[model samples]
Target chain A: MTYCVGIRLNAGLVFLSDSRTNAGMDHISTYRKMIIYEKTDDRFMVLLSAGNLSISQSVRELLQVEKIDGHEEEGKSGEPITIWNATSMFDAARVLGATVRRVFEQDGRALKQAGIDFNASFIFGGQIKGEAMRMFLVYSAGNFIEATGETCYYQVGESKYGKPILDRVITPATPLNQAAKCALVSMDSTLKSNLSVGLPLDLLVYREGEFSSNDIVCIDDKNPYFKMIHETWGQRLHEVFQGIDDPRWDGGDSAHPMMVRSARYDTMRKITHPGERIV
Target chain B: MTYCVGIRLNAGLVFLSDSRTNAGMDHISTYRKMIIYEKTDDRFMVLLSAGNLSISQSVRELLQVEKIDGHEEEGKSGEPITIWNATSMFDAARVLGATVRRVFEQDGRALKQAGIDFNASFIFGGQIKGEAMRMFLVYSAGNFIEATGETCYYQVGESKYGKPILDRVITPATPLNQAAKCALVSMDSTLKSNLSVGLPLDLLVYREGEFSSNDIVCIDDKNPYFKMIHETWGQRLHEVFQGIDDPRWDGGDSAHPMMVRSARYDTMRKITHPGERIV
Candidate 1:
């Protein structure tokens, strides 16, 4: 299991991934799940993967050389269209999908015969020189969906445990560093609640139009900023929880009371005797 | 989908459940997921359920008359045992499990034939005449596990989004009222993140020694206390988020800096050209 998040904000893009993988609880190991593809002044892309480790590793190995057909114009028929040569992020993602399919073609039947699914998914996002930063959630079936302004982020593997904070905080308008902070906090929640997602995080912040990024770091337990986030977020959450007034059962002079019953439904169904019917 | 939570503390027990059910995104409807059974002055119990609504509803209906065998003393051979007659909460839970098995025997084959799972789960907890407060998480196979002091709560359906708050706030030592507040807060997070879980909540708070509880309420959108929670929690959560310092990318004079990188791993794998191999 793993937890990885990719966010595309108005300011730029944020990519974060945990470095834990497990075959079972007893077989836990650390495996990095993020990869960067950069051509300095030309393009910058990042890929975060989760699911069967073997299949993902295969896809990553194949992705660099994977090519999509028909990109060649008249005289350019021999030129292979790869992630580095694609004109758009969409094209790069298609090549990634093709790479996934190639892995499936090679391993899917064997895995199925052994009673395992060819499970793998990826968050592929970045700029390809001419377009704005784009992000995608690619599925195992060689299909994908793009993230839009209305939902400016994509997450894969063990996503739900850390989702609420992202829902409350992220939007297209979020700033680069703020969104990065939010992603770390979200990862903190996942780390606290799930043993499958551990520390030593890989975080990369890409500023739009840079076509490359220098803000990349691998955070471990000793990292002060992540430590601060882990401690402060929990403490402040407790404070906020305590700050909210508790429900008043008596409906006293309080402006808000818990005694208010719903107008649409009857009181909760109570069965007092063995002969009673619920409806 | 549904979201329901039950918690047992030293002070008492708390149960909260949302009322929404949906077959698909377009077919959403409201159906209460909680039921109470009280034999005033003798016992009080609550049941919160999640999964296939039809199966749960059938189990609830059958549970009224559902009975276990052999509660009879030597001479009372003909006497049957039911939840109403069970002296301890454990015995009552056995009856509940038997009830679930009965439903499974009746409907499992038909549902399987239609390619639908016989999925349903329950959080059952309460105080019986001779027992301390107890709680159990009952699974679809009619097997159950009790909640201990270390892990004093159980949730069923759409559970992960609401779990972090419970992980942060709940324990055996928490007071009944405070646990109830925590349950509502947990439900609030679930509602905010999931559309399949909606308004009109059923909340029940029972004190340790009491056989029945008057602190039962059906809260809807108009409920002020819940409204306060909805507004205040989100606002305070944002404030708490902002209150934490954003990561200092420059490794400046700040006590915490985001630039600290892991010592164990190399910098992220970067593909510089189309011919690059990840391995």
Candidate 2:
């Protein structure tokens, strides 16, 4: 189990991932799930992965050399269609998808024989020189879907516990650092709720139009900013929860009364023995 | 899909369940998943179900007359032991479990043949005369686990999205009203994140030593207290999220700096084409 999230905001793109993997409760290990591929002044792409670690590792190793046939014959001159030479981000993602399919062709059959699912997914997103910043969620079948303006972020693995915050805060117009903050808050919730998602996070903030980024940080338990976030968010949430008024059931003169005569009460299937009226 | 939670607190107990059921995206309907049984001054129990609606409905219908063999000969004098006549909540829960097993014996084989799992669960908790408040999570196979002080609540169906808040808040010492509010907040999070869980909740609050309760509310979309919670919690949560400072990455003289040199940074597995230094 892992938790990884990638966001495409108007200002930039944000990528974060956890590093814990477990085969059983006893056999737990840490493996980096994020890989940063940068060709200076030309392209910057980050691949965040979840699912079977072996399959993802194979995909990543093959991705550097895997090539897809060029969509147009114009760019077909003696050069292999790889991420470094791709003209657009979409083509790079195609190369990534092909790499995943290659891994499936290599291992999918033997994996099925062992009754293990061929489950792996990737959050591949970044920018090339000529194209706008884009993001995609690559599936286990090597197919992919890009994030749109209406849905600007994609999260893979253990997504539900952290989703309410992302749904509430993220937008296309959210600033880069704020989106990063929201991602961290979401990660914090995931960490608190799930044992499989641990700390020592890899956070990358890529500003739009910059082919290379310097906003990469490796956050262990000692990172000051993440420490503040982990402490402040939980404390503040508890404070906010305490500030809310409790429901009063006495039919007292309160601003928000708990017991009101609802029309649906009579139709409810509440059971009681004879000579007892509970509603 | 459904969301139901039962909490055991020192002051009393709180039970809440949503009324949405879905077989597929096109086959969505409303069905109440909670049932209250009261025998004045003797017992007060609420059964909250989630999973295959048919199986649970069958279980609920059968629970009324389902009887188990008495455990002790002193109380086994030609009497059929049922929830209505059980002396302890434990025996009542056993009767409920037997009822579930009976349902499985009736329909489990056909359901399995049709490739549908015999999935069902219930959060059954209440106090019987001379017994303390007890809560049990009855599984499809009729095995059950009781909620102790260490884990004071049980939630079935779509439980993860709403679990972080409850993990942070609930305790055996929490008051009844506050616990009820926490349950509603948890349900709100579930409703916000999942389309399968909808409104029209049934909430019951019972005090210690009271075998019958009138503090039951049928809360639809228009209920004032729920409406206030839906409004205030979202708004205040947004405010709290905004109040937290965004990470500053430029090595600025801030209290929390984003990019700090870490020991693990040197060992990170960042991939890049040659001649580019990203860290």
Candidate 3:
């Protein structure tokens, strides 16, 4: 079990990952799930992974030097291109997909025999020297889908618990720091609801064209901002919830009445007696 | 997919369920998931179910006359007894479990042969005369576990998206109306994030000693309070989130600084070059 998120916005990219992993409740452990690839002025990419630890680790290790058939533009007719030398983020993602496929080919049979699925997925995103910042969700089968305006973020593992706020607040135009804030808040909700997702967190914010960044931090329980987020979000949320008027069952002249007159009410179904029919 | 929730509070019980069901995206349909059994002042119970619709529907049909051997005291050594004759909520729950087992015995093999799971679960709770109110989560195997003060609530199907709110707000002492308000809010979050859970909700709130309640309503997309909740909650949540200070990347002299010094930072993992090793 794990939780990781990647957001591509107009301002930059925000990546967050939790470190908790568990084979069972008794086997809880810490393992970082974020990786950064930096070539200074050339390219900047980040990978956030979730699923079988072994498969993801193999994919990450192979992704750096994994080669693919390059188009003739790179050099010779069939030069091998790696993530380090690829000219575009799409090419890098292809190399990553190939890496995943290789690992699956090697481990898929044995894992299936042992009753384990070849489960591995990743959020791979960043900027190449010339192209705009891009992001993708790479599936276990080595296929991938890019993030777009309607869905500018990708999350894997324990994602549903943290999705509502992201749905309500995120857009392509959200500012860099604010999206980072949103990512942390989303992670906070996840950490609160799931025992298998936890801190210290690995958070990295990459500016749109920076090819690299210093905005990386490892957040343990004591970090001031995360602690404030954990405390204030819940308390303010409680205050906000209290601010909303309670449902008025009386059907009086209230501003917000829980019971409204509607024809659809008659269409509702309920079985009230032993001999009652469903109809 | 479906969403059903039941809460046991000191004030009474609150049950909420959505009516959406889907075998696949192409086969989405509406099906009520809550059942009410009441004999006025004598006893009252509600069933909120989720899982394979067929199994649940069968279990519900069988539960009424589905009897088990009554204890010797009930009559001549082994007279029939059912939920209608059960005195304690615990005994009533046992009757419900037995009804589930009967359905399993009838359909389990056929479902397994077709590769469909014998899946079904229920949030069954209510007050029976001569006993305190109780709630149980009935699983597929017909085994059940009672809700306690610490847990206070149970949710089935598409549950995680709606759970954080419940985790933050619910308790045994929470007032009945507020708990109802909280339940609707939880459902609202689930609706926003999941297309499989749709409009027209079934909500019922029973008071501690009332035995039965008139405070039942079927809320559709047009309901005003729900519309208010759907709008105000997201807006207010955004406001609350905005009030929380954004993470300070610069480590400025602010009230909340995101980055603080910690020894664990040195142990953080990152890959800066193609040849970099994990250790």
Candidate 4:
């Protein structure tokens, strides 16, 4: 299992992925699941993948050389229609979809024969010279969906544990570093709750119109910022939890009381005697 | 989808379930997924269920009269070994498991033929005379696993969204109301993240020694306490998030910084020209 998230905002795109992969409890391994496709002034893109290793590797390998119909016509043979020359992020994603389908065509049947799902999901997002930054969640079927104003981010695999913070913090106008902080906090929550998602984490922060820069880092247990986040967030969260007054059964002095009278219904019905049913 | 959680603590047990069910997005209904069976001085049990509605309903129905093989020998003819008369919580859970299998025997084949799983999961917990309080997660196969000191809670369906907070807060020594508050907070997180899990909610709080009490409540949209929790938790969480200073990139006066210089690798790689890939 893996947890990968990509956010595309007006400011730019942010990408993060955990490196833990496990065949079982005893077979855990660390594998990088993020790839960068950059052509600075021309285009900059990132790919974050989750699911079976073989499938993702195939997709990555094929993506470098794979082509969509138009891309193949544009690029010379052997040069390959790579992420480099794509006119738009949409076309780049299509190249990605084609790469995924190529892997599926090659291994989907054999995997199905072994009762394994051809499950692979990708968060592909970036900026091209002519268009705004965009983000997409590519599915196993080679189909894809883009994020919009209402939903400005895409997360694939082990997404739930990290979602609440994202839901609370992200916006199209959020600054790049704030979004990065939110992503790390989200990753921290996921790490606390789930074993399959671990560190060192791959984090990339992109600023709009810059194509790309040196904002990526691998966060291990020893990284000071991550270490501070891991400790501060947990301690502060517990403080907040404790700060919230516990429920007061007697409607005590606290401004926020737990036991409040209601007009809607009585307490739950219970069967207190043998053969009794309170309906 | 539904969300139900059961926690066994040193002080007592806590059970919480949502009341939303949907056949499709177009057809939604509210159905309570909790039931209580008690015989005052003898026993006190609560059942929280999730999964296929028909199967769960059938299991619930069967539980009224379902008896296990060994327990039947102790009953008289035509007098069902009901939950009320079950001598121990384990036996009561076995009866619940048998009830589930009986439902499977009746509809499992037809459901399988229709490509729908005969899925139903339950969290059954309570205290029976002469035994300590216990909690069990009963599965479709009629096999069950108990919650011991190490793991004090069980959740079924739409559980992941709300799991992090519970993981952080729950312990054997947590007070009953606080645990109940944690369960509600958990449910709130699930409700916010998942459309399939909605209100009203069914909450049951149990005490260790008391056989029964009037602490259970059906919390609908209009319930004041729930309304407060929904509003306060979201607001307070946002406050906490804001209070935590945003990431500082240059290690200014802020106590926590975002970027930590490392010797291992350069920041994320970028390509400056078309056809360039970061290797």
**Which sections of candidate 2 miss by over 4 Å?**
A72-79, A261-264, A274-279, B72-78, B261-265, B274-279
Question: What TM-score fits each model?
Answer: 0.96, 0.96, 0.95, 0.93
Top-DockQ structure, candidate number: 2
Prediction 2 TM-score vs. true: 0.96
Q: List the residue pairs that clash in candidate 3.
A: none
Tens-digit lDDT track of model 3 for B18-40: 99999999999988888888876
What lDDT does candidate 3 reach at residue B101? 96
* Residue A221's lDDT in candidate 4: 88
Off by over 4 Å in 3: A72-76, A261-265, A272-279, B73-76, B261-265, B274-279
Docking class of 1: medium
> Can you rank all candidates by lDDT, best first?
2, 1, 3, 4
lDDT of 2: 0.90
Q: Candidate 1 lDDT, tens digit per residue, B1-279?
A: 999999989999999999999998998998989998878778888999999999999999888789788565776764566888888888889989999999999999999999999999999999988789999999999999999989999999999999999999998998888888899888888998888899899988989999887788888898888888888998999999998898888778888876753332266778886444432
Model 1 segments more than 4 A misplaced: A72-78, A261-265, A274-279, B71-78, B261-265, B274-279
| Cα lDDT tens digits for candidate 2, A1-279 | 999999999999999998899999898998989998888888889999999999999999999889887665665555568988888888898999999999999999999999999999999999998889999999999999999999999999999999989988999999999999999999999999999898778898999999877788888888888999999998998898899989987648978777775443575687787566756
Interface RMSD of each: 2.6, 2.0, 2.4, 3.0
DockQ each? 0.63, 0.66, 0.62, 0.49
> TM-score of chain A for candidate 1?
0.95
